[model samples]
Every structure is written in structure tokens, then in C-alpha cells.
Target: MPIHNADIIRIFEEIADLLEIQQANTFRIRAYRNAARTLQSMDKDVAVLVEQHADLTQLPTIGKDLAAKIEEIVHTGQCQALTKLRQQLPASLPELLKIPGLGPKRVHALYHELDIHTPEQLLRAARDGRILALHGFGQKTVDALVRSIESHIRQKPRLKLAEAAHYAKPLAHYLQQHPGVDEVTIAGSYRRGKDTVGDIDLLVSAADSQPVMAHFTHYDEVAKVQSSGRTRASVVLKCGLQVDLRVVAKPSFGAALHYFTGSRSHNIELRRRAQQRGLKLNEYGVFRGDTQVAGATEDSVFKAVGLPWIPPELRENQGEIAAAEAGELPNLIELRHLQGDLHAHTRASDGHASLETMAAVAKQKGLRYLAITEHSQRLTVTHGLNAEQLRRQIDQINALNDTLEGITLLKGIEVDILEDGSLDLPDEVLGQLDLVIAAIHSKFHLSRQLQTERIIRAMQRPHFSILAHPTGRLLEQRDAYDVDMPRVIREARQRGCYLELNAHPERLDLLDTHCRMAKAEGVLISINSDAHHPNDFDNLTYGIGQARRGWLEKEDVLNTRSLRQVKRLLTQTL
Candidate 1:
């Protein structure tokens, strides 16, 4: 494979870890690690850098030796030094190094002195009294290592948006409390409203950089200050999450935030726009010459370059630039435009709230209508509703609607899509409900062709009103099963079924790319929170973000219609 910048950066990170295990020279090891971070964050492609400059050794933090090594790695599949080190060490050594508290010195001691190559081998050594016999490795150390390994194995790979928000909120508050700080904002993937975040980026505007930098190192949540300087600081939190903080003057703060909080592709498009207008843009500001044109606000910056202001959510560089220039960016769906939620659960399923409480909460949120979409009987573990129970629930909803002053409740069910591309509920039972959300809750490992066919078959059903979380992804936790999304959108449009832009931060399924593709196929989208509780309705902002990225207009989203219009559309579909 012809490696891209991201691929090369990952290789460098692995090389740095292996070098540390070998007890290589501290400066050389630091060089490789720094190079990896720098490459990962660079806005431009490394291949372009290599092509333009033969001596990458001349680049900052890269010398003649590392530069040559990078060039070789880019051209070929391997590096000589990395290959030689791997040959001398066990293949499992790299995996073992990922264990918390196991540094290069301890790893070398275990390999050379204890002959422990794998985590299993080390665990056995700890149990058999061999680890205690080694110098500097005592009983407490062995116990700690075992605990660390256990924690590592048990920990899930991803965190939900609500979960990540909890961590960022406190840190943002702490940074804003400093006297020198003028403003602080969280940027990057989180700011773009991604469901799960890998790391958090905080940008601050400061009257004085030194004091703010000093205060950042002393934050209570900070486990260790990784790096600090006059303009930037990086620290690892107690939760093992890394946070990067940058301080800039008030005048340049907006531009700096835009530059640092990027998906790289977004920034590239911005830079290209600047270049075409005979302007230069950087972290400082956009300038026509030495005189600054725009830097105080993102809108002003874009307008100065002859383009309309592109919303942050739409700044993913996926055709947004051209759309902005042409004055044709879609009027995206907004949170205030949603009149009802189509997917929600109560105590009838695994949800924590009851039907009455959920309905009350929805009314409080100013919603005109709400759907109680408990899981179907097939999901026994979730206490999904049986056919008889659904009848009772429908009566309850009708009674609630009669009693409630301004809000109406709809009878809804989240019917399961079976293995053979049929719904768990029969047509007669499904027809009795006001709304039906068909979802694939299991068998996600099916092949692309099979998965696409399976979903299409369900959409073909007359009672299947909406397809919930089309790809069934949980952000960093699970890769979406391969499905021909363009085809799905076409089928849904042809069959008058709605494609949901699920608002649960963890499952913003059918991501922005697929959403845009769906719109191109004339498929109407529904932005639903799939809320399990009242608080989950807050996640609607993320779904709006996804909708904006997809260039969704008011007409494109079904929820943007009035309650009467929506009800009429549903009747027409049936």
C-alpha cells in the first residue's frame, strides 16, 4: 500500500515504543516520539514534504539520520533499524510494553533477566515467585503489574459523548478560572460533535502566556505535565487522557482556534481559499499583505475571502468550500426545528424512565409530539414488549394524549430485523402502531452484500416507517458493517421510508459522508436522538451537526415539518 501521512505517523509511534523497550539513547528515542507527534498534527501531507524537500533531515526535530529513515519507510514498507530491533526481540514484547507502569528499564529487565516475553508469561512469573527474585522487582510491583494488566484487559475501547462531556466540562471550567485567561474553548473532533473522542484539545486566549502556562501544570486533574512552553502545554490527565492547551493573544484567538481545531482536510480547504484570494492565512490571522484583514471571528475570515460563513459542523472540507463560494450551502436542520422525537424507550424496555415520565419530560422540552418506541419481544434481555403488552402501551399513550394539554404521544415500537430480512413483528401487529422503527440489533458481522440486502428488504415493508442507526456503529468501539449506503438511500427513497440520523453521540450512524450521499439520492432524513431518557434529548445538537455536514435543508429533514404535516406524510407512506 502507498502509505499516507496518517499511516506513516502510526508507524513512527510504534517504532518509538519499540526503541524505548530496547533502552536506546534518550535523545534518539525522544526524537522519534516528537517526530511522530509532529507528523500526526501537520496540516500538509508528508509525501508532499518529502517530494518538495529531499533533505527532510533539515526539518525541525529531524536530522540527517531520521530523515533518511523516514524517506526509506515512505518508499518501502519497512525501516532498517526498526526491522533489526524487532529481529532481536520477541514479537510479543511490543504488546507487553503497552501495560501501564511497564517502562523501558522494567521491560529490558523482564526480557533479559526473567525471560518474560508475554503478559501471560509475566503473570505466571509473578505467581511462581520468579519476579520477586529479580533485582528491584518485588512483591508489590508484581501485584501492581497484574492489576494493571487486568484493568487494561477489562476496559472498553470507547466512551460516549455524554461521558466525554463530563470530563471536558470540569477541565474547561478550571482553565477559565485563571486570571490571565480571556476565553477557553474545547476544539477538534469533540467540537465537531463526534460521538466518541480520542483526545481533547483546549484553546485559550490569554493576556499573559507565562502565567496561564504555569497554572495549567498545577490543575488538580492533571496527572503529569508532558510538555510546557510560553505558547503551548500538554498534559496527561488522571484518566490517562491527553489534553493539549495552546495560548494565543486575544486578537488572534479565533484564527488560532480554527487552525488548531481542524480535521486537516477542513484547514486545507480554508488555506486554498485564502491562497486564491491573494491572501495568507495562519494561526495568527488572515492577511492581504502585512496588514491583517480578518482574524477576530471565523465568519469574518471566510467573508474576507469572498465566501459565506460555513458552520463549524459543515467545516469538514467535503464540498463545503465550493458550496460556500457559490452561496448555496444548505440551510441545515437546527435543534429548535425538531417538533418530536421518533425513537425513545421507557421501563418497558431497558430504559430507566417510565412512559408517563418520558412524556412529561418531552412536553417540558417544548416538544409537540413524542413516540414511545420500546424494543420488540425478540429482545428478551431488555424486557422488550410482547404483542399483548404493546396493546396496553398503546392504550396508555392514547390516554396520556387525551390528558396532556399541548403534547401527544404516539404508539411506537423498535421492531427487530431478523436474519432472513424480515421484521420480528407481523404485518397486522405492526400496522396497529402509529410509528415503527426497524433496526438490526444483531448479526452485524454479515458481509456487505448480505447486510445491504437485509436492510433493503426491511425497508420494503409497508409498515417500516424509519430505519434507525442504519450502520449500527458505536464510534471508536465498533467499525460499521459494510453496507452499500447509496443503494440503501435509493431503496429507502423509492419505498418512502425515512433514513434516521441517530442522535445518540455514540451511534451517529450513517455519518456525514453517507448522509450527503443519501440526500443526493433524494432520501428524506430524520434526525432522532434515539433518546432512552429525558437527558438524552440534549444529544440532538450532535445530530444537527451531522445534518449540517451532510448539507441537509429544512425540507430534507422530516422532523422539520409541522406535526400535522408529518402525520399526513406518514399516512401517505402507508
Candidate 2:
């Protein structure tokens, strides 16, 4: 636990990087960066000064406040201000500075103007000509960036859907407003609600293809116009997301959407259906021996193939064709079906907001209940709460619940499951809460059998409620640790506990496929936004998308139930 001068320098420099990304006051940002330099040059260690009760303010750029912060980091191996800023932004964002062309100002511009947050996003932008679109970046800069990101993400690809949407929505609206553009619909895997989209496909219907294509290629965010034609155009947004736009006639709009908004297998199955009926199905229209049969509506397209219109999320050909034939397509879970969020946080942990603020936002978001599941001790980096602090938080939640209306706060702890399969908090303390969300914060390198047993043993423990972020993956930043997922899902069924479909865009754990496995096993899944801030509750949208993709119905979702039902279910786990 020795806090070396290098440690202070690194922390100071990171503080500067984070502040620069936020576009914070220049002088304050420079002070941290300068102090990091000051420490780098100092012959003596700052730790020894703290040990000897020496005055740090005497050092250059080390004011009283910063000196105290350094002392805090030295003593506890953390700084409160640093921890708070990290919670406010994406944890991996500062790492972007490691890329060749990304300086602090460019980082701010990329984040504020484009919503680019990760090295993968940066890489995607560079390849798609987005980075070169910046005001000061040249081909040389973007080229180097491409090299860095390519090297950074050699093992990672595909930006998350939420990241893709940051670029897709605005561009769609931009084209929708152009005169003569009749309809604008985003298609492809984006339309299918896949967790990650390789690219965005957009379909537009208009009488004049020229103006539509012109508008699309000339979009303000376009980094490069790869191709342009009378009816089709391809461009890369500055954010590195590729968008393909096709301007079809109003007559072919529905069929175009159906064909373009497809999983290839699903489209093939539809073609087979049309061929069986002696018709042809294509993007232009459906025809029988060259006689137009259906061309104007999606329902018409489905009707031409003797089937009902299927929801885009279910168009993966995963029994949906047969399900539609039998009138058994699932009434998939929607955002509105959720009545509560079983996991969230407040400033008492690494979260940015207060308990009341998070509660108010949850109520605004139409939730009947919000579980304040702050991280328990063991995640020292998060300043996770200890037993006494947790007991105090329980009392605080009870007091707030008494005065609140329309929404209740459930007391819960996102306690870490130790490597040996023991819960971080004593069972006595954990038993007092309304729920316990057992999680694995470390030992990600454990063997598959060890990891699987670690989780199963935790589930078997008394009062274990939900297994949070079961695979412990962080999207592009990290891989899901080795574990036997089928055994984990099957074990949850026997333990009478539930699994969390963590809705954090970065960690949408319980992958859609695992969700189906759990559903088949009759284990209900709780789609909770492991929200650190109030705005994070919006992540539930992504969670619902994942659930629908997994073919989960409302009955299979834990938070979709009434609070009374949820409580009864929680009680059964005890």
C-alpha cells in the first residue's frame, strides 16, 4: 500500500486528463498537470513528507487543497475528488489520450460534439473518416490515429448499439427534414435491436432520388462520401459509424424496409415463403409472375408471404417464422412493462447523485420501486460502503420512503462474492436488507470450474437475491471471464434466485443467448440498470432491447411484476 511519488504523479496527471475531457477551467486543469510534473522532478518522495508531517503547500503548484488531496491518496491509496470525477465520466475515457492523435482538447471536442467515448469508438471514427473531419485534424493525424486504434482493438470490434445511436438518430432526423424525402427508417442490425451494430442501414422513400442522395452525402457530419448514385449513397460519419442510405420510391418503401431491415437468414426464409406461393420478394416489391401483389406496406409484404408482420427484434429466424405460423410470436418485453429497477447507486458509493435525487429521477422515469444497491466493501476503488455505513443507509432509505410518494426505495447491497465463494458482508448484515445482489469484482482470472462454483456457492448462501453482471464483462474493454454459463443458469433455477440482465451499456451481462437459457429453465431475469447516476436509468432501454432479442416475455422479467409480487419472489429466495 505504499503510495510512491510516481503514484501521485500518475493520479495528478489523470485528474488533469479527466478535467480536460470535461472542458473544466483551464487554470485548475493545468495546476494538476503541473503538479504531476513537479512530483516527477522532486528528489524526495511525497509519502515520506506525509509520514513526517511535512508541509506540502510549500512545493510548487501544491496548494492547501491539493496538498490535502495528495495526503488522502497517500493514506487511503485514493482521492475522493478523483473517484468522484471517474464516476461522473466513463472510467476508460482517459485511456484515449494514449492514442496517437487524441490530445485533451480534441478529446473534449470528440466527446462533446460526437459522443465518442472509447478507443473502439475512436478507431471506428478514424476508419470511417470521422476523425479527419475535425476542425484541425489532417490526413497525417487521422492516419496515425487509425494505426493506434487498429493496434488497440486488434482483439475487439463492433461498437455497442447505444454508441451507434449517438450518431444514427441525428443523421436520420437531418435527412428526414430534407424536402421531398417522404419516409426515413433505419434498417439492418440496428433495426433488429442487436446489442452491437456493425453498421447502420437507412432506408428513405421519395419521388426524387437526386435530392435525397445529395442531402445524405452532404450531411454535416459526413467525414467521407464513399459512393454516390441516383438512388444510393454511402458515407462515414465523423463518429466512425458507417451509414448506408437508399432512396426508394414510395411504391417500394415497405418492401425496401422489409428487405433491408433484415437478418439475412430471416429474409431468405421470407423469400422461400414467397416462392412457395408462386411470388417473388425483393426490395422493390412483391410480384406474382411480374404482376405486382404487395409493395406499399409492411403488412402487405408479410401478407404476400402468408404471415403476419413480425416485430423487428424477433426477425432473427430463431423459430419466429414458425412462431408466426402458429400465432405464437412472443409478446416481447417493452420498457413500459418494467415497474421497478432492482439495482442503482448514490454518492455514498462511487455514484454521482444523492439518494433523494436518484429516487426522484426513478419516479420521473415511471418506476414504482428503485433499489439503492450501493457497492459494498471490497471495491476499495469505488469507496464502497462497509457494514456500519450500510446499516446507516438502510435507516436513511426507510426515512426517505416514509416521506415519499408513488415510489418506494428498497434497501440492498451489491456485495462482492469473494474468490472462495463467500459474500463480502457477513450474512447477518446481508440478511437485514430487502435484497442482496451478489457480484464478482475480482478473481476474473479464476478457472471455469472455480468461477462457476464461486457463483453457484454464493447463490446457495442464505439471502442471496440476484447474481449481478454474472459474466463480469465490460463490453469492448474486457472479455467475460471463463465460466460454465449453462451450469450457472441451471444452478440459479435450483437455488430459487434470479440473474441480473445488467443494463449498463458497457456491461450488458447475461448475454441474450444466456437469457434464453435462463428463460427455458424457468429462472426469471431482472433487467436492472446498474446506474451510477440518475441519467443512467435511461440504460433500461438497452436492457429491454436485449431482453426482446432474447425472446423474453413480460412474465419472464422480474421487474415487470408488481412490487408485492417482487417482494414475495424475493422472500422465496430466503
Candidate 3:
């Protein structure tokens, strides 16, 4: 197979790890690490570099010494240095080094002391009482290692948008404070508001690259500085999070951010559209016959391409390009469009915010109404409301409604769906609520057929106004419980039950594709923040992105209307 830059970089990184474990020369190992990163980030293929450039040594960070090795590896499948290192260290040792908090030094110690070379072997040792006896390793360390192993095994591979935002916000703040940084914003999956993020991307506009690069390396949150250069820097935080920062001049900042923040598919579609008009779209700027036509803002770039500006969420290239070309893109729902939050919580449930405080915060956000959708009695962990508690909450909500100035508090419950497809509360209890959000809280591992049936059955209930967090996914933590989404959408649409676009970053449950699918089926989608606290209301943007990606119009969303209109829709469904 022809080798790619990505493959070669992976090999070099493994070699560097093995070398470190072997206690090789520090500079030699660092050279390999540097070369690996440089290759990984390059736009061109490593094999192409060797084929086109006679002196591959000219490549950044790849001096004559590293160049020869790279050339050998590209032409052949392996390199002598790497092969020799593998011989000195079991190949499995390099894999072990990937575990968080376990580096080459620890790997070396574990290998020599306990003959541990694989995760399975290490786990066995930890469980069988072999790890604690080793020098510098103890009972606490063994227990932690075991827990890490279990977490690694159970954890989902993606990160929720909320979790991603947690990382992006701090980094963006840090970059903005840097002396040379003119402006900074998060881009990519984080910007689009996907439930899970593969990596956190940041774009910075700087007067000079040197100061920005200096500040990136010295950031306090950075656990390790991975790579730093004139135009870009990549770092790994203490939380095992990866952040890439790109610096561009003010003139090119917008275009660069747009290009780099792309889903590759979106960028390709944009370039293809530009090509049809005899123009070129790239990171630096959009060009027509060597003249820079658009370089500053994303809107100009789209105009230069002869299309109306598409929102970031709808930029996934899934019919969006065609829609933009035809000027048929939907007027995607916006945060300002929301008249109220239909599913929120207060201290009555697991919510930290009080009923009065939650209502006041919603009003502060310009909402005309807010629903206090505390958990039903099923979720004891969240202090779910029982009959007595529900009555008390109803009274409090009524009192708050009377006293509140700008917002009305609606009595609501996020009632759990039992295994047999029944609500946690009886029909009498459910009938008393102004809004009821039916959700599946347990038995997530049920078969797709059963899970879909479970949710579809809940939607059949006249009292169930909304289906909350349809997928039950925690970004970077768990996969969506298996469910027949198409069937669920069809059934929900048929029954007039709204499918929720949960705004929680960790659970943007109605993902873009699902949202599009639901829209296609004529299902009404509700973009809800599902805010547990006031600050979480910010996540509404993520939900809006999903709605936009689905090509949802203002009319398609139930919450986009005024408070009276929303209440009317809810009543009609009831």
C-alpha cells in the first residue's frame, strides 16, 4: 500500500515513544517527535514530498538526519532505527504508553518489574495484587489504574458539545488575552454545536505570530506543549484534551477560520461550488483570476461563491450547498426565536437553581415563559418529585407565576418511561401538568426494536407533549441507546408529539442527520436548552445549529412562536 503522511507520522510517534521508554538520547527522541508532528499537520502527503523534493532535508524540522530516515520509511514499509527500537522494547509497550497518566518511564518500570506489556496484562497484575509491590506503585495507584482501565473500556469515543465548550471557552479566553491576539473564536465541530467533538479547534487573529505562539506554549492549563510554530500551535491539556490554535493576519482571519473550522465535506462542497464559477476557495482567501474577491468575513466568502450565506450548523454539505445555490435555505430557528424554555428544572429536582431563580433567569434572557420540568418520582438520584412534592411544586409554580414580572412558570415533569413503555407517573398525575416531557431513563441497552417501541408508545399518550433527549447519549461518554429513529420520528409526527433538539452539549440528542430525517417526515422539532442551570441556556445555539442543519424553518419549530402560540400548540397536541 502507498503510505500517506498520516501513516508515516504514526510510525514516527510510536518510535519516539519506544525510544523514550528505552531511555535513549533526549534530543534524538525529541527530533522524531518534532518530525512526526510536522508531517502530521502538513497539507501535502509525506510521500509526495520525498518524490518531488530532491532534498527532503529542506522540510521544516526534518534536517538531513531525519530526512534520510523519512525517505527510507516512505519508499519502504519500515526504518532501521524504528525496527531496532521495537527489538529493544516489546511493540506492545508503545501501546501501553497511550494510557493517560502512564508515560514511557512508567511503562519501562512496569515492564521490568512486573513483566507487564499489554493493557490486559497490566489489568490482571493490578487486580491480582502484583502491581502494588513494585517500587513507586502502591494500592492507590493500582486502584486508579484499574478504574482508568474500566473507564477507557466503557467511555464513548466522542465528546459532548458542552464538554467541548468547557475546554474551548478557557482556551479561547487565554488566546484572546495574549498580547498579539486581535481576536479569537472556536471553530469546527465545536462551532457547529455537534453533540460530540472530535477535537477542539481555535482560530486567532494576530498582528504578529511570535507573541501568540509564545503565549500558547506558556498557558497555565496546558499540561504539555505539543508543537509551536509561527502560524500554529497544538497543545494537550491536563484533561487529556487536544487544542489546535491557528494564527492568521486580520485580513485573512475570517477566511482562515472558516476553512479550518470546516467539516472536510463542507469545504469540498464549497470549493466545488466555487470551481463551477471559475473561482477558487482556500484558507487564505477566495480568488477569482488572481484577484482576492473575498477574504474577511464568512458572509463575503459565500457571496463570492455566488450563494447566500449558509449558517455554520448547515455547512455540513448535506444538501446545504444546493439549497444555498437555489436561495432556498430555511430561515433556521435562532435563540431569539424562542419564546420560552419548555423543559427546565429547579431545586425541586436535581437542579441547582431555585424555582424563583430559574424563572427570573429565564425572564432575564427575555423569555416570556419557562417550564419547570422537574424529574418524576422515578429518578430518585435527582430528587425526582413524588405526588406530595409535585403538588408542592405546582403551588410554588403558581405563586411564582403570580409574582413574576415577565415570565410565567409552567408546571411540568420529565417523567421516565418504564420498561413496558409507561410513564413513571399515572395518567391522573400526568394530566395535571401544563407540559410533560417523556424520556427513557434506564434500560438503555434494550434492543432497538424494544427501545423504539418504548418511546413510540409514550408518544401515543395524549399528555406527552415532548420527547426529551431522544438518543440518550452523553458525548465522549456513551453511544446513543439503540433505537429505530425513523420509526420513532414517523410515530411522533403521526401523533403530534414534538421531538426535542436537546441543547445540552453532551446530549444534542436530535443530531443533524436525525433532525433532517425528522423534518423530512414532517415531524415537529422543538429546540430546547434542557437547561439545568441559567448558564446552560447558552447551549441553545447548539440546538439551533442542529435545527438549521436539518433545514428547519421557523414554522417547523414549535418553540419559535410567541408564548400564546406555543401554549396553543401544546394544547392542540393535548
Candidate 4:
């Protein structure tokens, strides 16, 4: 019933997808897409802003027309334009957009040429060779389409961590507000800091389960109550995220949290250890010959097993138990450990905020330094900076640094790693900046060896500092490009550059496994927000989560260093 930021984002994005399918005006489609992006990167709720009568048009890429639509969505929970667009086209057409290679033009081509609409039709056409006959759908592409569809169909649906937060966080808070609730904690993959979550596991500890169960099932966001019981309920939220709530006895709360928050493999190993010790472990508590030993707290549960309490993020059966036994568990990096962000954007590129504004917000967020790394000119769609523009910006950064008090802006550019692995900008301009974050903007389908080589070549550049979003993945939308990540990590160590753990929710690149790989190779990772909006600095939270899951420590992250320390390190790369 309440309008959430995710709701608005979904509506606007759907509108864009539908419009693009209908072959609408390019700018119109872009307007909707950009508005959706602005909403995604922002920390504040648009509904709250609307309630305060804030000027929505002042939000980046939001115009008067889009503002009116936001208000409509808030008041009525629907968009009239999206409704009409659905009427004009098959509502199922938007599903085709989910196919990896199917952009609007391709979706339109498939629809008009092969009469494909839904994913089923598209899949059928691709398998039947109908898609390959279309203008741009080559044989290889058609083959890839079939595989992508098959994989997508077989894969379970999940929400990105940030999107799931939209549902889980608010729901947990709502449960906490109930009179009888003593404690509420979200468990499962959401608690484990996984990049994507299939469902949310909510555990409530209260003396009376009836009131809490009733409150949960009757919550406003519940689209349907699958089942309800005295102390448990299963419901699907309006956003298609499944949530299961269990009311645990106050004494078993920690055990319940441990059992439910498990990575099954980790729990299995723990149960095996308990068996060896002549103790039994389960959701209720640890027991020795029918006598309860430990269960009242997570720390107590771990103590019963002769292990220290492991952070939830590290409970993935990833050698964490062995490390705990050896007392070598990393003090995982936290959001507070960061002192600077090496890769970010401003209006000089596709970013929404100005340099000064971004600086102020970064300072307010406690970052001592923020790099303004505009996209290099090779990325024309973002109005990326040319050599001359970058030079002028370097001068601007120098002048601004002189007058600024708290946060210093570092001159940098996210130069594209071209197909042949050369840096997009020339050395003369790149050498003048404090740092250069080389990246790959296109050619995501290169062979694994080629992709790895391309990145290695880019990192070998004289002025290279970091590899931004090393894998070029957009969670749920696109898979990481085929590349040898371990080889790349070693290459980074050899070349004296670093890889970026891009913190954007959509692209938490450098998978947790890769983060561990980098750490082992003695390569520091710069956990950068890659912010396009001022508020996007909040994304550092997710970055820290991903880092902790990878078993990273404060020493493994580049941005944890003070400005003078970081500058000294950056100088080595240069």
C-alpha cells in the first residue's frame, strides 16, 4: 500500500521497456530510463520528497513531466502512461527484454519479423532458426539467445541485495514496531550479504507469537498469504519477494538465527563437528545427551562447538572454520574503514551531481578524498571527457583543492579499455592526473583468454591506477564477461595497479571469490562507489558487505589508507 523507491523504479523501468518495444521516441525512452537510474542511486524516498512538496524536477534527469508521473504513482500506485502502453502492446512483450541480448530494437525486430513476443516465443524462434534470419541476429547470437533463455528459465528468481532491502528492511522495522515483539532479525542470504537473495528469512523472538504472526500476515505489502499458523507465516510481497517469518522462543533465538541464516554447507560442517564431540546441534539448541549446552546466543552456540563466533557474511563454508580454529579470522573491512573513494563520476560525464556538490556530500559522509573520474571520451554516450577537457578538469581540481577544507578531489578518468587493450586517452593527458581507472565499456563477449589479456594490457599502462568494475557485470541483468579473474588478479599485482570492487548495487563487480583471489595475491582492492549521484556514496555499504564476504581485512583495501598514505601508494602505480 505504501509507495517505495523500488516501486517507482520498477514502474519507470517497465515504462521504458514497453516504450522501447513500441519504438517510441529515443529521448522519451531515455527520459524514463534516466529517471529510473536517478531513483535507483538516490538514498531518499521519492514518496517522502513528494510528501514534503520538494521540487522533483530538480532531481537529476527528472523533468516537470516525470515529476507529475511520480506524484501519480505515489497517489494511485499506478502509472497511466504505462497502462496505455500496455494496452497498445502485448504486456508480455516486456518479458522479452529480460533476455540478455534483446535490446528494444532487437525485441522490436523479433516481434515484427518473427512474431515473437514473450520469452517462450523468442526461445522457440531462436531454436527453430527463425531468429537467425532477422537482420542482426547472427547464428552465434541466436545460439547464445537459446542458451541464455534456457539458463534464465532454469534459474530461480532473486532480487539484488539493494532491491531486497527495499522489502526486507522496512518489513523488519514494521515487525519491530509491534507491541509484543522483543527482537527481529532478517536471516538467510540477506543476512549473509549475498549479492542476490532468493527470499528473506525473518526470525522474531517474542513471548506471544499470536500477535506478531497476525501483524505480519496483515501487513500492507502482503500480496498474498501463502500460509499462516500460530507462530509462523509465509507470504509473497507485492514485489514478488517471498518472505517466511518464524516466531522463536526467546531462549532459542540465537540458535534459530544460526540455523536459518546458514549456508547449508557451512551448517553441515558444523553439525559434523558437533557429532564428533558427542553433542547434537540443531535449530533449537546444542545438546549433550539430552541436556542443553548452548543456544541462548550465537556466541554461545559457537563456543559450544569450540569455535569463535563467525561473522554471518563469512559463514559460507569458505575455509572460515579452519581460520577460526587457527585464530586467523580476518577482522573484515567495514564501511567505516574507508577514508577515500578512488573511482567516481560527476556531471562531466553521465554523473548527475556537480563537482562541488559531490565533494560536499563525500566530506559529509566522512570520506577525506573523492576522485572525480569522468568517463574518457571513448564513451561518447556519457559525454565523456576528451584529453583537453580532462586537462582543464585537472586544473579545476587543483584550484578547488586549494579552497576546500575537508575533502580533496583527485583528478582521474575512467578510461575505456579498447578492444585491443589500449587505454582510451593518450598518455600525455592521462599522466597529468593523480590516478587513472581503466575499464572495459564494451566487447563483453570476448574469449576468456582474450578478455583477461585485454584487462592485463590495460593495467600495464604507465598511468593506470585501478581496474574499475573488473568483471563488467550487472547483477541479474548480465553475467560477468568471460575472463580469467585469477590471472587478472596476478597481473594486477605484477603491474602494480589495483582492481576496483565497484560498489554500485547493480554491478558489485569483482565477485567475492575474486576479492579473495586479489587479497591472496597481495593486490589491494579499492572499494569505490563509482557514484553517479551524490547520494550514491551510500553504495559503499554494499561494497563493504561484499568485501567482508570475501574475507577481506582493512589492510587488503586501498581506500582504507589516509590521504597521504594513499597518495604514496598511487605514486607506485604511476
Quick one: best lDDT, which candidate? 4
Q: Please write out the lDDT profile of model 2 over residues 469-573, one tens digit for every residue.
A: 989987655568889999998999998999999987768788989998999999999999887777678889989988988889999999999999999999898
- What overall lDDT, based on C-alpha atoms, would model 1 receive against the true structure? 0.78
Runs with alpha carbons beyond 4 Å of true place in candidate 4: none
Per-residue alpha-carbon lDDT of model 3 for 1-574, expressed as tens digits?
Answer: 3455655776788888888888889778877876765564344567876788667766556798888888888788688888887888777887676554466788888998888998889888889998778776767667767876666656545555544554577668878887777889899877875656777888888878988888887877688888888889899875567888888887777689789878889999888878989998899888888898897888888888887777877777788888887878888777778787888877677665688877877788888888889899989867798877898888888876778787888888999999988888888877878888989889776777899888888888879899999999765445578898989888887887788888765577787788888878888888887876665566677777767767788888878778788788788667
Give one digit per residue, the lDDT tens place, for model 1 in 1-574: 3334555664676677788877778667767765764454344556677777666754445677778878887788578887787788897887676675576788888899978888888778877788887787767667877776776566654445545665676778888999889999998777876666778889999879999988888887688899999899999876667889999998888788788778789898888878988999988899988999888776777777888877777777777788887888888777888898888888677665777877887888778888889999998867888888888888888887788877788788999998788998888888888878999888776778999999998888878888989998765444576688888988887888788899876677768888888788888788887876566666677788778767788788887777788887776555
Question: What is the model-wide C-alpha lDDT for candidate 3?
Answer: 0.78
Q: Pull out the clashing pairs in model 2.
A: 125-240, 130-238
| Runs with alpha carbons beyond 4 Å of true place in candidate 2 | 1-157
Compared with the true structure, what per-residue lDDT tens digits does model 4 show for residues 217-324?
999999999999998899999888899999988888888899999999999999999999999999889999989898878999899999999999999998999999
Candidate number achieving the greatest TM-score relative to the actual structure: 4
Candidate 2 weakest lDDT stretch, 10 residues: 36-45
Pairs that collide in candidate 3 are 158-476, 162-505
lDDT of each: 0.78, 0.86, 0.78, 0.90
